[model samples]
Target: MGSGPSLLHREDIHVVIAGGGYAGIQLAKSLKNKARFTLIDPKEMLYHNVGAVRSCTEPGFAKRILMPYAPAFGQNFKQGSVTAINAAEKTVLLSSGEMVKYSHLVLATGSTGTFPGKLPDEMITVAEVTQKSEAVLKLVQEAKKIVIIGGGAVGTEVAGEIATDYKDKEVTLIHPRDKLVNGESSDAFQERLKEVLQGLGVKLVLGERVTNLDELPTDRVETATVMTDKGTEISADLVIPCTGLKVNSTAYKDSLASSVEDNGSLKVNNLFEVQGTERIYAIGDCTNIPETKMAYRAGMHAELLAKNILAQETGGTVKEYKPDPFIMVVSVGRKAGMGQKGSSLLPEFVVRMVKSRDMGTGRYWKEMGQKPPR
Candidate 1:
């Protein structure tokens, strides 16, 4: 709402942030000095609320989770989606055909996927999240048998949300892997969720492959069906796919192709600076930072980037971003959750209270410098 609390170093130094997600907005607000900032994103609100993954099954939280971006960054926030980046020229081209020049550029545009949670592109407005949440609530209300593909965080959370909200509805979570959140969560952590999901009456279809979500047929009977590779035909009132999210790496693949992986994720050195570039930096889902691509890790990347960029300008020391030991949560419902911080296991009651209750919804509003929930 007010001027950045820190002092801008020079009048000429400008920081152009690509996405208005957690990292982009954090860097914009944290930067000090006379440094100018231009945050570009098509969406009017920041949709980092993972709580909405479950809350959308309910009516009240489904509407309250999407926070308006206008309140996050006042005059510095721009309305557009980035189409291209010129590391040599130090400029970013917007989809609107406008070129924004910056002394230092930070790309925080997270990944996109087919799911409603994975945005198709830079979003058009903040209202879209609210609309999707409302529609999902309606879907849950009418659907009798709901099936979620991928037992990862999103699918499991959705199952928990729907099962918790509508006790009578049949919910199922199918994962091709033996364990949930295979590369991310520990085995003990996944076991805890398996218990929670099954306890809530969610059918578990683990270690089974669903060939293609498209081939799944839904006839005039108003029911959904998908055939598994195991030759088991699964039927449901609703089928949702939670996999398939590729890195949004196409923007720099031409000139900086070597610096990116096959997955479209840009490679960076320890400093979070995009390799082979001087002033350009990439963070969050787009970077190959070896850690889980969650909001908390993105915030850490932004903090390190802000510090390092400022140090480069002010002749100070820059820090490298090594993800702090694993800290994650899985919300089975607003009343149930499980997670671990470092080597310590989080109790169900604490998880429920700290995260599952409001899914850290209020704290995110505060992160954006908005009014706390009433």
Candidate 2:
């Protein structure tokens, strides 16, 4: 209630972070000691969705997967979505009809994948996403014939989780390309993934694109089928679409300093700041930063941006952001997984030991400044 820990008084250094996911939260933590921070998000907690696929198989772990903001920051958080932003005015209009002013703004608004609509327009908050994820888990539990559409990380992980855990259920992974995780991963990694899937008795349907989903009979559980471009019908009782995500840059569309990409990502300069704009930055999947849209990368971007902004405020030269090479640690269940570390493809057993064994609870513990399990 009082003016507590005023690192910035009378608009000294007010950093208004737009999203409280990995990027925003990491940025907030990085600057918590140096600035008066206000973190805004619609959800009360952060969904650590990197471990979400595993959570589907082990439903009880969901509680441990979420990170709450209030406990992490004392009285520096707000629960509301930013409905609009006026860059010229340096103000963010919230869904609660409150306008928050900022000297520097970090647009870590992130992205949406499952929602089939415009970015932010059809956006579901973290809470809703988690709830829907629970429903998805339940659906998987009841489903006998499961078909996952997309061969990306999320899709592959989902398929692997279902196939390895639900042995009796018929699982099939459908991809438009000939190999899973097509362009993002190495050939060795792809082959290893296919081998793991085959070992788990998971069927792989490749080189086919879904053309129709309405042609299947409605009565039988196995009657639900997808017609591919190759004129093949693949049947399933449940269909999970993990295609891709669109950046949430609608609020920044009209801002003079920001540019939107064809895929709906915001264009940011080398400093991780939105180009053509002063004191405004964008990070994570919402920005065209030439890196994988993983949580770790977002956190790194936010950390660099926070330091650069602080240096700028002190009349020091801003730091340039160097993105790390993409690394993928994918799980095939609790005991097996695969990893692409920098350039080398490793076995699933190594990946499981590094990531999947604890479903990243150890990572969360470390992020929260706690010691990981022994």
Candidate 3:
């Protein structure tokens, strides 16, 4: 894998990218013209997880978010999972028992979390997600009192959607941290978010840990009595947990065992290449890049990785990757939200205009080379 006549041809360069989430798709699209590429994922449709929170209350919204991969990648996309990576052989084993060879392998397998924040592995299609949302909506409608565990962005959004849609239902959001979003946001942003959620009839129970919540199943809406460390018992017909995300790195663990971090994330250098491996890279939420895991950051990783990969083929100097400043905008129903850009807190109207209106669904649809629904 040196600079030679074989490397000069773009068609001869095969870049195999694992995962079809934000980073994988963006990287594949960026390298489509620069090299021969293949994108592998377990699912056929690219679930726009940003809009998944809104889908629980809004009927028919799933169609807009869950987009088909065929339109974007065509034959270059393979609907399967990357079971194992053989860096020594320069190939990968797919779950379907097929061996796909590659000139460069990019490990962009993102993290997995609970529903609404992230889709389950079993839900591999738009239809499955749509059906699940419809079912959750039914539970939301029928339940008298609903409880959401965790005060992260996902939990806050879930509480907001349920409260906004069903004003009569008693909605309570419980968090171990005093401030919302795990207290990661600024004071101004957190205060404003609390005001917005309270205005929507959502009860805030902060700085209280749900002691028995770990024993309950969070995949579905179940009736349970959750007790807090402060000796408070809140009974609800529906309970949802928006917990932490687990990194998806099983494919790389066996062959590149030493590259995996203590937290189960892959160790990558400033160039976005997996540490101790040449031409094998990792990006998105799966990498141990010291920054908040967000879709925008993953997109940024894709842009830089594409440039570096192309630069390497031409024997050009590779640029080091730098993470952008922390930025986040959370949607609270359709018209309300909170955001922070760098050290400044964004105004409510700006947040709505940029994200709260439609959670940036149209932008992603356009990014996939598809026209957004009118």
Candidate 4:
């Protein structure tokens, strides 16, 4: 009834998507019918980390968040990480000793948080973090005191979720700056976030420099006591460090004509393509795109790149990727959040109604071709 079967029989278009995260999966889906796609990722499943913060409170959400690639893309899925990329050869070398050739390559390797890269390779996915979530939750469940080191959205959300859900827990958010949600949000937005956190019984430890983690116990269920530069110790049973993300581009560092920024993100061109490379493109947290590394933006970038690549192949005008100005919707736990659309700070109710309720899980489910559960 459709040209899909007939088109599948022909092998004209070949696309290789590295890193089956937000950007890679969406881009692969966009070109699934039009091209022969090979999705490569170290993990067998595609993790939706948009709801990662909420997963700390709702553990069951973890299963729904991680969507497997094999079911979504069929034979196109390849279970392995890309060890290297050869722009000249237009091929990607896998960790499994297999080399896959590509007509076009998309790097959507995403990123990891400020965790030291000392952990074994096996525990890397959202599942690993989710598995640790319960242990972390157990600490929170028993802890009378909690200290969140970092005042970003993730840190704020973590503090809020804990304070709101587990009211018994004493949560204290420590930031090195004078105000919370620095750089990403406006002053008004930061004030609102601080107000919300304070209202929900979270101790706003602002203008404090954490010199060291002195009283963090050696046991698994231990408190995180941080010592300030002024020799003041703020102790808590649980400490969730929400620093920044580190882009995963080490594999392609030597192979491609790529330049890393001061923050370690790869610099890409207007077309989302890595500079000086025709067949290669970088997206998501890995690229130094002038945007917040959100899942929605990554999906948008991937879709744009896939369309442009297909257009280039078929002799159509290529579309350029101009990132929309920074728009952040941060949830201060259930039914409360702060959003900044460009420079405009939307009301807290607007943010809550749009994003805070479900952590954008419904949007992700629909995008991934799954019917969101009622």
Which candidate wins on TM-score?
Answer: 3
Q: Per-residue lDDT tens digits of candidate 1, residues 239-343?
A: 767775677654566757778788888888888778888888898888987776788788878877877776778777777767778777778888898888876
lDDT of 4 by residue, 290-337 (tens): 777777798889878877876676667788888898788888898689
TM-score of each: 0.92, 0.88, 0.94, 0.90
Clashing pairs in 1: 7-32, 7-33, 8-33, 8-34, 8-35, 9-33, 9-34
Q: So what's the TM-score on candidate 1?
A: 0.92
**In model 3, what is the error at residue 293, expressed in angstroms?**
0.8
Cα RMSDs of all predictions? 2.7, 4.3, 3.2, 3.2
Better of 2 and 3 by TM-score: 3
Candidate 1 error regions (>4 Å) = 1-9, 32-34, 217-221, 372-374
Each prediction's total of clashing residue pairs, residues at least 3 apart in sequence or on different chains, is 7, 1, 0, 1
Candidate ranking (TM-score, best to worst): 3, 1, 4, 2
Candidate maximizing lDDT: 3
Model 3, 257-281: lDDT tens per residue? 9999987799998988889997899
